[model samples]
Target: MLSDFLALFFPRFCAACEGALAKGEKVICLQCDYKMAKAGGLTDNNNFVAKKFFGRVHLQYAWAYYLFNKRGRIQRLVHRMKYDQMPEIGEFVGHKLGAALLRQGLQHEFDVVIPIPLHKSKLKKRGYNQSEYFGSGISKALEVPLDAGAVVRTVNTASQTKKSRLARWKNVDSIFDVKDMAHVRDKHILLVDDVITTGSTIEACALSLQHAGAASVSVAAMAAAK
Candidate 1:
């Protein structure tokens, strides 16, 4: 009972709600997890996430696990995951996404899972890529290989926050480069990321993968802004 004694003194809090985590709970409490808004129609070919890239990129599938509301629990969870050095939060959410997709029989649709890469500078600063952790969880659930080194972010563009849609697209356009075509060539790729706003970053990454000869590219994210 030493673990229980330690927990009594140093209780772990839920990442989303900051409530004392109950036994068997990790990262997020069950109540908060249940309350988080889920993106609907994930199995549809023309789902919301897929529609975001219409006329820009051809995605084999596209889905997001949650609807991101400003100041919501998802926002807090993502903030802590990205800025608070808690990458486990991403993996937790991603595993849920992978489980959902697995239930829909979509696990085998992708040959590899590629998290959108961060620039070297940001990677060094963050010490971990949140998306890669997300991809890791998905890989574990879906039984797909996770490849973080196949692609690289060539430019460390400024944050997309507060930027107009057009500006956001321009900022991320052509910023991704495929380092090893063998990993992606003629393979169905599932691109994973934390969030999607204007969809510019995902579009850019998909385009890069397509140019590198990926047979098809799909997208998955932890959340998408409404």
Candidate 2:
């Protein structure tokens, strides 16, 4: 077949392992996908992810897809998505996340998917919000609408990449503002993000939505530091 001929000439490598993908393999090879970490039981409302926000926010449900280890395979994939100018990576991973959540019966739980916002300046430079791609993937799989602009970053704080957990929390207060309440007021929103480091960013946005009268809020991310 023409596809087989093309495959022989130009085999694609897995994003995580750099191993040549066999038939049916996409961004990540089957072997890598099998070995990649998971965030664990998705149904527990009081899971590890929920514990992160204890005393800070009341999450309806909260979890991540994978464990984030420094310089690991997951980290490599994330770096490509965040800095290697590979936007499609976000779309693909998000789709996978959405599909998993859907299989777990979370499809009907949220009315809308909202990405944590980026300031206009950063969005312009990045050309897209990574979290929006995640939300879009969730929207497509779960058949829910994506409200990409529900929140706005009023202040462009310094990157939390190098900051300590306490410092990250200190840098994020009052940085997010909900753009409008019409859609969020009575909806249960699923807040999506790329990776959760200090949990400050997602916490801030979740509180903003709750304060604005969202019926409830849940959180999802591609990965989280262990």
Candidate 3:
């Protein structure tokens, strides 16, 4: 077949480790998949992720797929996915997280999924919202539809890396607004994102959904800070 001939000429490599991968392997090799940490606290109320946003936002549940340590494999995976236009990596992680949550009956608790939206400028430059790609994978695994444009980012804020927690909160406040509330009103919303560092972005998005009359909000991401 033509595909087989192309594969023989240009074999794919793992996105994280950059090592040779098998014929069907994608961003992560099989070995790395087994080694990657899964989200264990997804349904727990007192998980660290929920605790991080304590007093800032009222989350029904909050969890992430992997523990992020700088220079670690998880970090490498996220970096490649975000910076290299490897959208498949985000979806892969999302599927893993979604499947794990599905096993615990977590999928049924939410009625809808929404990705943390990126600003139009950034999205235009990147050509994709990594979080939406992640959400799409989760939606596919859960048999749910993703509301892609449910939330819109209106302001372009600077990086929150070096900012203090309070400053990060200020930077993210009012950056997002909800669209089409009739579709989301009175429904449980599962907010999706690629990662949760300071929790500012998700909190802002959650507030917008809450203002739009969403019954409840839960958060999921590909990874979380350790």
Candidate 4:
């Protein structure tokens, strides 16, 4: 009751568009909700994200939820979730994305969901892994457990922005280490991330998992940068 009283005077607002949201609303206004582009939840390999990993990661399936561009609403949404302590935004998008996959009968193929790990120092500074927050939402919707510890980032690498494809791959080559190979043995792992640019980070993580005995790997993200 006290919480409700406080809410009456201070209603929550959408993180992306900054509009007043009704009680229990998380983030993104109703109008902005309609603006979101569903990249793919269908069973097809022609999606933009799947094309990026073709012949590279051998994904069982791959897809992203939005086409991200500079100054676009999708970019703004990602920025808020990554830097603004708005985990609800990630969770909200993840749930909708998961539901879409479920409708397409694609959510049952994965045995486990794993988020790309950040270096320990970076996690300490950021207080959270933004990708993990999205994985949690998908895990809840898909009734699968999240393996947040399946992979570990061993080095604090420089940002990939403005870096060439070869440079990014070099930076991520030896930066990931697999943990507890036994747990991931013969499993189809779904690797999650906030975004995919050149995909070096996801590729590195997939390689580490493959070496550790993963049967297959699929990938997902909140958005894909073009």
Q: Residues 1-226, candidate 4, lDDT per residue (tens digit)?
A: 3224434554388666778886556566777778866566457877778888777778877778877777768888899888876666777787777787777777678899999998999899888898998888788888778999988999888566777878878888889998878768899998999998777888888888998899999888998876
Whichever of 3 and 4 has more lDDT, that candidate is 3
Off by over 4 Å in 1: 1-11, 159-164
**Which stretches of model 2 miss by more than 4 angstroms?**
1-11, 159-170
Question: Which residue pairs does candidate 2 place in steric collision?
Answer: none
Evaluated at residue 27, the lDDT of candidate 4 is 65
Residue pairs whose backbone atoms clash in candidate 3: none
TM-score of each: 0.92, 0.89, 0.90, 0.90
Error at 99, model 3, angstroms: 0.9
By lDDT rank, best first, the candidates go 1, 3, 2, 4
Candidate 1 residues 28-74, lDDT tens each? 89999899898876768888888988999899889899898888899
How far is 127's C-alpha from truth in model 1 (Å)? 0.9
Residue lDDT tens for model 3, 51-102: 9889988988898988776776888889888887677778877887889888
lDDT of 2 by residue, 10-102 (tens): 448787888898878877899888898888758787777778888988888888888888877999988877776665656677788889888
* RMSD after Cα superposition, model 1: 3.5
The per-prediction tally of clashing pairs is: 0, 0, 0, 0
Q: Candidate 2, TM-score vs. the true structure?
A: 0.89
Return the TM-score for candidate 4, rounded to 2 decimals: 0.90
